[model samples]
Target: MISELVMVPTDEAVLTGDLVVPGHVPAVVLFAHGSGSSRLSVRNRAAAAELHKAGLGTLLLDLLSEREEREDAATARHRFDIPLLSRRLVAALEWLAQEPNTRDLPAGLFGASTGAAAALMAAAERPERVYAVVSRGGRPDLAGDAIERVAAPVLLIVGGSDEAVLGLNREAAERLSAPHEIHVVPGATHLFPEPGALEEVAEVAGRWFLAHLKERRGPGGRRA
Candidate 1:
């Protein structure tokens, strides 16, 4: 419940996020927030807090520049840009890999909406570095070519009624060579911010990361 927020200097802008370290951090999660959202996004911040309670360290990152956000950012209603966001997500990972308190943590990604695509793209680009991936109402189809290359196990969490995106996620799942699963939150919509919905997403994601980020495994869940 009591977590700390900090900003680390990236090669470019100073990257900001909260880090919640448990008694012994079993793994780390880097949060990629969706369109027009910042590291302060409440759903992500809450999820990070829960993950820390579940024994994972969290780094919730902001994925864009003020200038780019103002000029090219999506409108309040529709602001999802996959490609531009992906690059920034990757850069944030590179920054985390060097930051002292986080450097050696076995890293995973928790991405929402378009942020999911960026997380997948980063996982693909830095296969050896990223250990697991989870997408909440993700548009990972937007990741296109990068989805097939991801080395970590991926969990795609979508709202059952978010039909079009669900189809896109299924299509992307077929292309992934990594160990993967797609779980739909029944009766939920794109946001999955409904009561108990975010909680379900966090629980599933924590379990997935625990399975994949470990040094040894024996089918509490599958692995790639």
Candidate 2:
């Protein structure tokens, strides 16, 4: 396994992340954290651990620089800047392609909250590289027109009780032309704090990645 702290250089700033890839894993899932969250998010860490059990790699990144995070915390700025976030994510994906350990493996994305929208945008921008996408309590509606361009299969995981976001997810699902599904965690809230709720999210997400990431795309951008 390769586990380390890495720096991803973007046009504007350098982002820090924790990368862990087990030996012989099929794919690496890059995590896009929600507003105000970081690479150290407990929920995301738990989910990454679960993915590891499925022989998948994971990279948990802070989409913001330290200065930007502090500023966002105080003024609530930068977190909702979907374009900036998506650009940073796209940069990370490019960096991963150049990284020695992950260069040959297919990649997937796991986004949470607003980060989901950014992930979708990045996927739209780099369709040939991203094999699949998974969103956890995500705001895919925020992706706007980019949702229609994503070529990879997608999985939307929402808490059953997060009604407003669930409705938004349903609307976004309708806009997506790519293969997709929505999995609702019964009685769980937006953060899935309920007992066993997050575990369920991790399990289902792991399974989805296992199924989709292993398949190669054939002609006309369809899964083979």
Candidate 3:
């Protein structure tokens, strides 16, 4: 596997990220970390490792800059700004499309918490670019009408013990227009901190992305 530190330009800021690509990768998964998290998130990194082992490329991006994150940490202002976050995610996707290494690969998204809303919104906006989406303990209901516009297949994975979020995922699933499913991880909480719970999340997510991303690929292994 090859790992590179990349700076992705957006309208307002140049976000930093780690792009990891394994040999013979067919697809790339962009991770949208939840509120109060960055590319250094342990869970997201763990999941990315699993995806890499599955022969997929991964981008773990810090959606917010250091200054912006500090500001949000102080005021909690930008964390829930779905439109802003979506724009940044879309910018990253555009950048990826232009990069030689990942330009031809189908793209998928892995979102957690509020980042799921941004991921969904980005998917809705770029239906031709994104092929699949997986949300781990996500708040998809926060996506509102944008959820209905997403064409890519979505898999919402929530912890069974996290009743409130599970309910939210169920409600969002009802509003989805594309193929979608809600998978509840038993004995796990909002963070899936229980032993083996996070592994389950990673396994399910890897399978979902591998299947859907490959299915969405165009001729000669390019993104359709």
Candidate 4:
């Protein structure tokens, strides 16, 4: 496996990211962290590790620069700026497409919290590039009309005990025109901090990405 630090250039700033690829990987998963979180998030890291073990490459990125993170921490503005985040994500995806190590691999998005909205919007914008999407404890509703435009298969994972967010996910799922499903982790809350709860999420997410990515790849490791 190879792990490298990558700087993704966006229109406004250069975002830092960690790119890890296992030997002979056929697909890659890009993570979109939630509000107030970064590439160092333990939960997202755990999920990425599992996906790697499942033979998928993973890219975890910081959506904001150091100065932007500090400013957003104070004003809480950039975290909820879905369009800005989506554009940044799109830029990262474009960068991946040009990179030799990951360009040939199918790409998927795993988003958490508001990042989920950005992931959905980006997937909608680049329908042919994104093979699948998974949202963990995310607000897909925040993507607005972009939800209806998404062409990739989507999996929405929510905590069983997080009634408020579960409701929001349900409403958002209704607007999706793509193949989608909602999975609830019993006894888990919005963060899925309960024992074994996050592992369940990782398992479901890994399976979903692998299955869909492989399907998209088809025979002879070529895009179908």
Which of the numbered candidates is closest to the native, going by highest TM-score?
A: 4
> lDDT scores for all predictions?
0.80, 0.94, 0.94, 0.96
Give the local distance difference test score of model 1.
0.80
Best by lDDT: 4
Task: lDDT winner between 3 and 4, please give it.
Answer: 4
Give one digit per residue, the lDDT tens place, for model 3 in 1-224.
67999999999999999999998788899999999999999999999999988889999999999999999999999999999989999999999999999998778999999999999999999998999999999999888799999999999999999999999999999999999999999989999999999999999999999889768866996656
Q: Model 2 over residues 15-109: C-alpha lDDT tens digits?
A: 99999998887689999999999999999999999999999999999999999999999998899999999999999999998999998777899
lDDT of candidate 1 over 135-219, digit per residue (tens): 9988888888999899889999999889998999999999999999999999888888577988998899899888777633336
Poorest stretch of ten by lDDT in candidate 3? 215-224
Candidate 3 stretches with Cα past 4 Å from truth are 218-224
TM-score for all models, in order of appearance: 0.87, 0.96, 0.97, 0.99
Q: Give the TM-score ranking, best first.
A: 4, 3, 2, 1
Clashes of each: 1, 0, 0, 0
Model 2 lDDT on a 0 to 1 scale: 0.94
- What residue runs in model 4 are displaced by over 4 Å at the alpha carbon? none
- Better structure of 1 and 3 per lDDT: 3
After superposing candidate 1, which stretches have Cα over 4 Å from the reference? 1-4, 8-12, 72-81, 215-224
* After superposition, candidate 2 runs with Cα above 4 Å error: 217-224
